[model samples]
Target: MKHALVFVASPDDKPAYREALLMLGRVALSRKLPPPDVLSGWESAQWIYDSVDGELRQEAAAAVAELPVDWALTPVAGRKKKLLVADMDSTIINVECLDELADFAGIKAEIAAITERAMRGDLEFEPALRERVAKLKGLATEALQKTYDERVRLNPGAATLVKTMAANGARCVLVSGGFTFFTERVAEAAGFHASRANTLLEDATALTGLVQEPILGRAAKLDALRSEARALGVSEQDALAIGDGANDLDMIKAAGFGIAYHAKPLVAAEADAKIDHMSLEAALFFQGYRRGEFVS
Candidate 1:
């Protein structure tokens, strides 16, 4: 099959730094492949080559491992997906909403520890979430808004990634195990077409310390990916999924192109590609979109 090896660097990197690494990448890839198509001047590029299965991913990784550029090897056919399904918490936003909400309850440390374990796949997601929400019981619902206002910020290139893909006609959806309170706001903030998440049941003034039944966990995330794809009249193979936690693994694996964006160990290990050195926009470049074609 014909494949593309994409190299992406941080947009904030100095010109000299970007140029030096891209130069190294060109030199390394040219030895076994043709000259690359520059996706972004000195920032991103792609080298197309014919390979069986993906024997070249490891070779390409070794060639550029010493440099700071992030790379992805994907088949040239169907590189541009029709749908984008991304996770919320640490994937789209900087901090976990639940953890920040816990800060207002004076239990941020305890809640954050459980969050880490859940994301790392050490504990069951549904049970872990229930345990965390249980601790936030009796807390004023106003803290939810406070957390969004003070602690929730999109990760680098998040808006650009979503807006660019949406402008190009892809249906983008934000699916999360986090509460709908954050996902709805985040979906609007990031310009996603729609969003899905678990709901936190609250009383007139405070949280009831309970979540709606049938929580949106790992299985739910995968279901969202498929259902969204179906709504677009496409198969799961026409979708692109990216996330950073163990709960995201199912959808990540089910998508045509699965990406781990600074993900946990298990997710990073199983993903088709990982964006460890670049921003979220790296996902765009991996799909053969040029920098000039980006919407934001």
Candidate 2:
């Protein structure tokens, strides 16, 4: 099978780092393939090769284990996907909305603990979300806007990733277990085509301390990916999904290319690729995007 091993460096890193990575990659592949195709000067590159032994990912990892570069080794056929389904909290955005809301409720530490455990796959995601939101019972509805205005910020390269993909004819959707209050704003802010998330039930003045039934958790996220792909007239293999939590596992595993963005252990273990040392722009590099072609 034909595969492309892509390496990405932090945009802020010195050019020499990627140079060293290219040299290391050349040695690792040992002239089996032509020199890498540079996607961004001293920032990203890809080596296309034929590997029939089926140990491609391991070989690629071993080749750059000592370096600071982040990488993805995937089949080259569907390198550029037609649909992008991304998780909001801690993936597209810098902080977990639920945890930040917990801060306003004066129960941040406690709520954040459940969040950590749930994301790590130590607890069920749906119940965990409910438990966390329940703790915010009676909190003013105004806290939602406060959290959005004061705490939420896009992770580095988030906008570029979404915009570039959308510009190239892909449908980008932000799906989260977090409330729609944040997902709606985040989707618009990040240039996503649409958004889907749980609704936080509230009265005229405050939270009802209860989320709507049939929470959008693991299964729902996967459903979103499938439904969106269907609506786009594409196969599941024509999609890319990314996230950093256990709730994202189903969709991540189901997408043609699934990436774990600074994820918990379980999620990282199952994802097709992971971004640890670089920004979300690494996703574009993995998809063979050139820096010159990026929208932002």
Candidate 3:
């Protein structure tokens, strides 16, 4: 029997899902869909939310090889895809928290320069974080909430992605190159199971303008991936890691599937899959989902 990616999605997202399905279908049409239950080179079939009989899928693809057709089906939610890890800054929200904070401090130009370097893998992540955080020492801690209220917006499809993934017995982990203040907030807002990030200095109620010593750098992100995967009892292949910067590379590499979400050039090129010019919903495609079994 042959093995192929079974792409399924939900009806709510059907328009995009349908588009993705037809794309996969085109591939199946090309090779006449490999014979299922018979392992061979060009063997794969794209199916909607059906208990895809390997043999059946191959038959269908080969049966319709000359003509491409759209398979309309909806996903059955809570089917369970576990262990989703995401980066908080640009991936979860529309902007990087530190960059916004820096802008608030009137040092936007300087901090943005450093951020670009860090995101592109040019400069080390920790040092860049430290330098940026140090510039905000005098801002009131209350500014954090105000910023959240003003600009800490979640990305499109973020709520649906996290909620659906979590409902499927998946353990969600938020790992970021940013600080804990922001990571923690994101974790709570998004219903993530756990989160890890560097700590920032807050003396009582005011910003200390510094990250804690021994910052959680790139290696730390990797550790979070491994630990969460182990805890979730899923092999590395079942893991889904998402991020958008250089610091997230190691962690992304450590997971079964690494996604570069609107990332810097370096990260987008290095990740297992790239979510370019698209929302997090694009990540669902790499999972090879169809609309029949994954939507609630």
Q: Which is the leading candidate under TM-score?
A: 2
Question: Residue pairs in steric clash, candidate 2?
Answer: none
Tens digit of lDDT per residue, candidate 3, span 1-296? 22334433343554544454466656555556542221111221243332444354445434433332222111333212468888898898888888887777788889998999998999998888888888889988887877778879889767667766786667888887777877888888877888888887898888988787778878888888888878767776677788898988987887767778878888876676565544565455435443333343
**Each prediction's TM-score versus the true structure:** 0.94, 0.96, 0.76
RMSD values, in order shown: 1.9, 1.5, 7.7
lDDT of candidate model 3 versus the reference:
0.67
Return whichever of 1 and 3 wins on lDDT. 1
Candidate 1 lDDT, tens digit per residue, 1-296?
88787788765666634664556466546556666778887678787777634346666677677777778888899889999999988889999999999999999999999999999999999999999999999999999999999999999899999999999889999999999999999999999999999999999999999999999999999999999998889999989999999999999999999999999999999999998878899999999999889887
84-123, model 2: which lDDT tens digit per residue?
9999999999999999999998899999999999999899
Give all candidates' CA lDDT scores. Answer: 0.89, 0.89, 0.67
Put the candidates in TM-score order, highest first: 2, 1, 3
Off by over 4 Å in 3: 1-26, 34-81, 288-296
Error of 3 at 226 (Å): 0.8
Tell me how many clashing residue pairs each candidate has.
Answer: 0, 0, 20
User: Which run of 10 residues does model 2 get worst, by summed lDDT?
Assistant: 15-24
